[model samples]
Target: MAGSVRLIPSGFEFVDDVWGGIYRGGSYMLIGARKSGRTLMGLQFALEAAKQKEVCLYFTNMRPKDLMIQAASLNFDIQSYMNHNLIIVVRVAPPNDAYAVPNPDNYLIDYLRDIITVVEQYNPSRIIFDELTPYIGFRNIELLKDTFLNTLETIEERDVTSFFVVGEPATEKAQQIINAISQYVTGVFQLRKSQSKINNRFHGGNIIITPNVGHTEGQFNFKYRIEPFKGVTTAPDVDDVPSKYADIKNSLAAQQKTAPHYVYTQSKQDKNEREVFNNVYNYNDFLLILNNQIALYKSTGQTFNLVSVKLNAMAQTQGLISLNQLQNSVQLSTERKDKICIKDNVLMLLIVRSNPNSVVHFLSRLKSNLPSDDIDYVETVWENISILNIEVNQDIENAEELTEESLNKAHQDPGSYLPVNKFI
Candidate 1:
């Protein structure tokens, strides 16, 4: 905790033993697949350090303004820190088309040299590279690797902590470059998704930290939720206005309409009021209502008979239903006496035979009912379902064990298993 580089005190928590030595002047690498929250976590670190009045410099080769806005929304106290010159963000734009850094010999070296100049001018305690993989292509991995190691050495000599972020989905050559850089860094952090033991289900993701000589590994996972402007804490949950209300407020302001008056005021009262009413009659709400109706039908074994019915209802709610006369727009039928049927505005499914395995399979398929774009969300929901299955299986095992024990007792006492039916 007394090291030159220390994690700032925040509600953020780490799991297991993943906090490798983050001492000041050390070089650290953060690697993850795209959208795995790598940049967000790095920005959070920089913001936390700035809160402590430590000079922190952030360099971005991607997403500069978006990162700053996200940091600001987290109630990072950016203004206060900026007033104290504790935080500085340096944006790096790829060279323009006319003057682009051509298929490179050492273009990135020039960029790093400029970055070093900025570091020297600021003399900050902490420095971060948002991502360097893009700037350095696959063919130039070794050169980038060497330059990165050399930069680390220089930062260490100056007692400045250096943090670098790398993303995946790059060429194999880029991965090789990262692998080489990984060797020289004092610490490496990798974030990845893994299957859960509960049921071979996948969870969000966890971070793994590897430390250099004389340091231990660190691991952590983030469980996030939106918090009011105050900050994240564990005292008690606060009743913040939902996102729908916020959107309505923005719409009202854009239209220059008066916001609805509320009985009580909260933070951003005008904004929340505008959003609340706008969402009530929105098209999105109508779609949700129709979707809910469809869900009810599917859940009650009416899917086969009502498939067309549900689709028509959905199309009607979405204003996509046509009034044109058509004889074959919908159809219905039964196959193998299974009570399957479908027609316009009607759908049904019959389960004449039921067993544990078949029921489980049916439920699993039903659970997969989500839009294609929401695959990740579906996966998460399935993971939860798998965990429930594990719990049920465990309970069944416990019941069988109890029944065995009862039978054994009956055999020993010659009367323990006597049936109540006999007495009746």
Candidate 2:
């Protein structure tokens, strides 16, 4: 009511008549079942936004090239806009090739990092994040909440808008989670398939937009269909946020003082901000898991080798660059199930379900995988790094003993990779 509302049209004349399209700089959620035209609707919206001369960042799970082709098929010739960078399509995923990581939280961190990097680099006013099902399985409601909360904060800081897509949840609990999270957004739109009464094939679909912005009342719906060059269609990417790209981005004080009278009360920051990553583990977190495993092993008779990796000139704790370098080495030398803990120049690893004898071979070859030790963060050469191990069992009360013993063994030789320590 105070500031003017910049409405990004949804490309549908019927729906925009009442709601006045989607607000600029606001994040919105679009929920739909499979084949419910979620991707189509997002694509159409992106096309329309580009038409209004807005720079759009379309993050799709599909290849950017293929998404461009699909956009052209929808009667929107976007090639010129693509060349001009009016609509930049990016195939979004975590930085690491291995999607699965030891810590689920780490995975989310890396994914969020990717999003942040893209936003900072391109600085697009609008963003479209395609699907949520692939990343947030809805198996973890906490993960979903974290993803949205962080995304909202990021969008607000940049003053950009976004559209995050969520697949229709089958379970009641998931729907409940969605309902709970919805309070933080400016709007929630549900795209449902309106099937034909005759054959049950998709004849058309409907969109229910429940706008929280302005003096807009309860939700409303409209019918639509996909024909050749018709109903809807990059839709390449993950669940979205930017106040929404099609129709999304967020804030409370910001939204309140601005055009729309809506306020987005953010989810509490009660959860840890530690991101999901494929590459590294926070030392404290890894230590807790190590102790738990030690306790569990005492009864179960399951044992794991404790490899103490010492990088020379390494600080007591790892910073970002060094950690990423170490993470790169871990990716090259260790298995996905293996857990690494770094503290005070020593990197302790629990290579799960691995060969005791092959551990030495891994250590021998790992040196070759280290980044050029000449790099700035790495003060000394790789020659100073020592990889040694000790067999860990119930007798070892905690991780400290395991690492301490292995360090002693490495100190004994100081030059070459040592064999498994026989002194329990």
In terms of lDDT, which candidate is strongest? Answer: 2
- Model 2 C-alpha lDDT per residue in residues 1-424, reported as the tens digit of each score: 1225566565654445454456667778889987677776778777666665566888878765667667766776666665445677776653343356555655655565577788887777778888754555434667767776777777757767778787898888767767756766778888777756213533566767787655253476665566557644212122321223333222222232354311223321111111112334666667777777677678776667767775544332433235445544654576656777766555777776556665766654454455543455333334345567666654688866766666565566555453222211
* Alpha-carbon RMSD of each model: 25.2, 15.1
Candidate 1: tens digits of C-alpha lDDT, residues 207-245: 555666334433333432223342221121123222333
Predict model 2's lDDT versus the native.
0.61
Off by over 4 Å in 1: 1-12, 15-21, 62-64, 95-103, 193-203, 217-424
Clash counts for all predictions: 22, 40
Query: What is the clash tally of candidate 2?
Result: 40
Model 1 scores a TM of 0.46
Against the reference, the lDDT scores of all candidates come to 0.47, 0.61
TM-scores, all models, native as reference: 0.46, 0.50
Look at candidate 2 and tell me the lDDT of residue 357. Answer: 64
